[model samples]
Target: MTLTLAIVGRPNVGKSTLFNRLVGKRLALVDDQPGVTRDLREGEARLGDLRFTVIDTAGLEEATDESLEGRMRKLTERAVDMADVCLFIVDARTGLAPADRVFAEILRRRASHVILAANKAEGAAADAGVIEAWELGLGEPLRISAEHGEGMTDLYAALMPFADAAEAKTAETAPVTDVAVDEDGEAPALPGNDKPLQVAVVGRPNAGKSTLINKILGEDRLLTGPEAGITRDAISLQIDWAGTPMRIFDTAGMRKKAKVQEKLEKMSVSDGLRAVKFAEVVVVLLDAAIPFEQQDLRIADLAEREGRAVVVAINKWDLEDEKSVKLKALREAFEHLLPQLRGAPLVTVSAKTGRGLDRLQAAILKAHDVWNRRVSTARLNRWLTGMVEAHPPPAPQGKRIKLRYMTQAKTRPPGFVVMCSHPEKMPESYNRYLVNGLREAFDMPGTPIRLTLRSQSDKNPYKGRKKPGPSKLRKHLK
Candidate 1:
């Protein structure tokens, strides 16, 4: 098991900055605003030779139980419980505030191991605040600057012992390769470990993307409000639902290209696009009141073009009055507008009321399975023969076009290669026909299918020519 460290602090103490530095990526959003991080985000961290799992948590705050800040504090406390070590951070430039002391006491009581870090200690001006951190009574304060990358060597030393012990323990109990044989004198296949399924939720502004995620987690782990564009960064969280581990990404809502004029919005959109590319399954959430708009269609088309498993989710369904009529209309619009994602799962969900979430989860898993589906070469060729017999290829320029063989080249958006006599002469309509046939025959829906055409005549034309002519001429000259 890897060592887990949690960075806990009050609002805007550069906890996220430190996390981004350790993870070697700008995964967590950084701004001048406080409380930007509202959930616990985990990443693989490396500092010199130390490797561990680092968590960036929401700032601890004092508030009533029903308020948003209170909810955020609860989430942060959960992170503390899950961590093997807690790095309690304080702003060295501003000294220790009351909230910092309160959180420090909380960590001292709850966590078994704690490291005191006085951040923003890059300048001489922060010397007094660093000294003040000593008053917390948790050992020596490691004076460091997360943003400037200072004093990391000392931090590495503090964490190295724990990492080494964890590694040694893992080595001692490692699984053995030797196994018992069965009655037939054959070894049984070892059980495979399943990785967490990666899913990204994306949609237009104010489409309840964040709300849906919070509902799934059964907590207000993500910040939500009535205003548009409240989520400026793509935040990922790991959750286990019905015994399956899932890493879900909550992304900023994307607007039309023409409407996105601000620089910040552009960056947010780009971040969301990156999340989509990294995700194995993408749920395109739509507003129930105005579902399948032009922008919605464009977003779904983008997922298809990226060759990702797609699931269309209609959110805020609790607000819709005409359920039957609206569902009928949405289904029709889905087929008409996004024909490329034909037969994909369309699920209705209410993020606020937590309705129909089970169906949505099922659809997402089903889509992922379809995305990773593979067809054997023998079955693929047999299917291809049937397809060609059903509808012959169109021969351009009066030349006969023959599709010689077909085989699946890869899975995960299921790619295939078709060898033919005149590949260049194959029309786009025929390609679509074959792709559609593959989807239907293989029970693959809403997952991208790739079909590549290769010409058999691409081989060398003059392979058997003898080299005797040049030798005969040389001999005559001699």
Candidate 2:
């Protein structure tokens, strides 16, 4: 509950500018133009060692009921609701406007804590408008110029109490001690551990998802029941297994919307989606009794679509009759059902007995390591050359598809861009072939491999250059 301070105002009142000043970075898009910032942006703010969550909201404006701006206004209202304190800003140079009055009324009703700020108050010219801000009945206005960086000390002093209060609240709510021992049974060191690698455990209801996490932690921290949809919010636990730090997120059993009833359940679905977005690795849990169902496939496909490193965990493996046969059948079904996540780590585990927790942890860490692995440009080009040599690109329209150069653009799903003579004309089959080759070469079999083809003809400098630019001394200077 770090105090969330939202900087909100009408268009072109220097809200984003003030945000950049407070956050000490140009995170929000800043321009003289009005309504340049449409989305609500969040950043960590620090003023003299005091920390708080700062939010930059969209410019509030008058809107008709059916207009696009009206929808944007609704979004802004939601941002206001999320904030603990609202920094209501007004333009000190332009004086108070009707829109500012409207926003003041909104904040008066909504915000528990409000700080009235008169921005652009650097000189005597803005003095009149700074006084005008008091007419809104929201106490003394903070006179400051966000662009010129004036009057920040006063702002910091005003925000100190809220920051301290939030810190106290956080200390009260956080668990006293939530640490899991390593395999060697030593008290795990706290606070200085590795950054939490977000891992989402998602599956249908009654898939032993919570039980699996409890086994890993060696405690009954998460509630375990046979009932579906027991866990509403996506609860997260910071766990250390074998010296590796991981943030395990236990998501609710996501069901089809048609079957969902309560509003809380809908929010639970949204929570699951949020967890997926936050996660770097997603472990799609499956019941050994009913493996590779349509819902299970959907969950795994969603992880692949999100470009997350995926591992399929078949839970309750200890209870399965003909365990070896079931495991083999499930593996075949997994490969056949979701080819997009081919070779994904499918490990059997008993959440009740902790049969395969070690294997699960190992697979998760391996997937995470591979997800962050970046292939060198030289290695990528060599792999591409070998791929091309093994099976040449298809000839379409009697022209050989010329793939000139290939380079990895980014990792974390291992995206590569192939600069080619004709990108659109390159066959889809060829793209799939190259993707498979990349997976095999890079040892990134299960993760999604992105292969993009860019037509390099226009990118060649020779095509865009004029024969000669004005100066004859240009060549001599070179």
Candidate 3:
């Protein structure tokens, strides 16, 4: 019963900017160019006391019925229809235009409730557009500077009605608790038995990774003395933060090969890589002073390739000023910096002060849930059928590669095994397409998605009409 809000507008109307603002993270990609955001991105949003789900949709444009732009528009409209409320954003600096009016008409005809926002309204230059928004006839415009986070309180006030209703519905329908309880209601909590979210804190040397772990644990459990490479062992500790159980792994720091002269440092580096493989969710800790080093992207790519849920935590945020400035910049950098893991979770936290520890843990849990998610056979086939219609698989070597069926093989990393006519002959790019579709359909981003092609055959070796072996014939001849 999560409340859903859809942000819709033409391109460069600050939809992503407002999306990032509401979600309190740089989760969506933001740029000055139009159409930078292609998909409908959803995240948990918080505004003042209101918390709900928000979907940032692609810019709407009129195009040919079956063109890509039209498809993108259809996706946005679909989101609008599904949402409890819609936030129609218009650039306050530019005032209303024909394109904005067209989008308004579309939403007016379909969307149930629309909240208008005049974004980028920081100074006098935006005053006129704020007044102009009244013409849209949705309601009084809430002048907001999404980049600077202005007028969010007023926005929150407007959202409380929807949020409260959604929350009430959730409370009424949610199942009774007591995951550990039985019929008798007498159950002892076992030692280290709580469902703790498994998180691996990893990064390069002196990225303040160990220090972050120490702060989260609220003690020197990791033996942090400021000297690099002090923590060689990948120690796992169970702790509770805000009533949430977490299994935290503090690994040895990694360093570049050119600088590693000590034999012990080399082992520590190898140990860190091994720890990454072992984690259910990996938090790639980065130093705020120097963000996204080449090795950092490599490690993140490795985790993604290995099919692990990834959350990038930019540590040392307490030292930065105009924090939003840096957060916005870092996110823009990450889009191009780690395109392989595009849409991966990126969080800025002062692990030193535990500023964003709760959100970080929540993001980790979400990524893990997505990683372990499995779609039912009926729903999967339905989705697959639609996908094949949208984009049919190509013919390889004069034969159409028939993907007969698909089923989730296992969970940990959420692997899918597809039974097909010729798995070996399936193109690698086609495999990637299936993987990407699985990720988008399941809403799993920042986690490695595994799609394995498999051929179905009889289990028995002599299932068909096989007769006696050559050995039996030779025995008769002897």
Candidate 4:
């Protein structure tokens, strides 16, 4: 059983900061601005030896209607309802405000378990506020500073009882297995077996990356707002999609190098790039209204270069008019701009409205399968023979280069090695031809295909040596 803790408070009370602290990563975007977080973001959190799910929610406001703030408050209340325990935080520097009091009363009435925390309690200025927090009547508040990493031991102590209860319940309900089972009882593990697929969603700023992930999850699992660059760190969440277990990473939007001027933005871009490298399949989400921007092409090309399977998702299809014409134009632009991913699946989805999500999921699974595809050595060699016969290697120096052999060196990007007469002299165009041939022949479209050429001479020991007629002394004696 996984325990869940929701950090709820008024605006700018360090809820996201505490979330980042507990998760041991900067997953939530933190700034001095209030209401920077408008959605509920959940992460696996750890404090000392206790591990549980932590949720960072938007600030609790007094609104209760259809306005944005009202919607945000409703979302926070939903999180409070779903959580096993609510860590209600108050600003120790500013003391307890009327809004905090209101929310504290709301939690008192709603939540079964509540732990009041006085954040920013590291300085002498917070002493008065820390004392004031007791007036809220939610028990003794734990004094802590989320930014400086203070008072976690007390927080851990406060959370141990809940953790223990969860663990006990889990142990009680867990199915028992026989320790001394038959040797043949265990199932065999095969290569290319069922493993969780790693998919990374990457795109330019405000391309609805987080929105798409949230729609796929069917919950507000990541913070989404009108603000661009709302997502900073690359956050990963495990989910089951149509019986397929997948680990999806929602990454920060990558802008052009010239536009990425701030240090924090640079770090965000670097984190996004790392996620793409670690992922098996990368979904390059593009804004449907602004289909193929320069940055979009760059991001797609980067994923291709990283050897991850590429899937293009045109987001915000709900907002696009004349769907047929727009989709045709988008496809033409995709093919023209990104020839490397020519046949990759181009899915149109409205992440906000949850439209076309089924197709997106299917496309992702297909791309993952293609990424893990492996061709047999015999088939690869036969294909290589045909390719050589169809279009022979270019003779740079009036000497026809002999293509000797071919075999699949590896999979997971489908790497192949070709032993030939002058690998260093092979033209770039010829290499492209072979790669294109492999893609078309094996039906490996959009997935990265690695074809390496090796000089056969490098593998031969006496390729350039002249053999004497036996040993000179033995020949003379005979």
lDDT of 1 at 53: 100
Pick the winner on TM-score between candidates 2 and 3.
2
For model 4, the superposed segments whose C-alpha errors exceed 4 Å read 31-36, 61-68, 123-125, 171-195, 219-235, 255-271, 318-322, 352-355, 458-478
Q: What residue pairs clash in candidate 3, if any at all?
A: none
TM-scores of all predicted structures: 0.81, 0.61, 0.55, 0.84
The 10-residue segment with the lowest total lDDT in model 4: 186-195
Runs in model 1 deviating more than 4 A are 1-4, 32-35, 46-53, 59-74, 77-85, 93-114, 123-125, 132-139, 156-194, 261-264, 458-464, 467-478
lDDT per residue as tens, model 3, 1-478: 8789999999989998888888887656566667755556677898876779898888888874756577667778888999999999999999998988888888999998999999999999999999998998888999999999999988988989888888899899999976777688868676435567777888887778767877887864444444555555465667786676777777777776788886556655766677778788999999899999988887788888877889999998999988888899999999888866767788888877889887787888788888888788888788878877887777888877777778888887788888877688887888778778887887878677678888865367767866879999899889
What Cα-based lDDT does every candidate model obtain? 0.90, 0.84, 0.81, 0.89
Please give, for residues 31-69, the per-residue lDDT of candidate 2 as tens digits. Answer: 665776554557789888878888777789789464546
Task: Return model 1's CA RMSD, one decimal.
Answer: 4.8
In candidate 2, list every pair of residues with a backbone clash. none
Clashes (N, CA, C under 3 Å) per candidate = 0, 0, 0, 0
lDDT of 1 by residue, 99-161 (tens): 888888889899979999999999899999999999999999999999999989989999988
Best by TM-score: 4
* Cα misplacement distance, residue 289 of candidate 1 (Å): 1.2
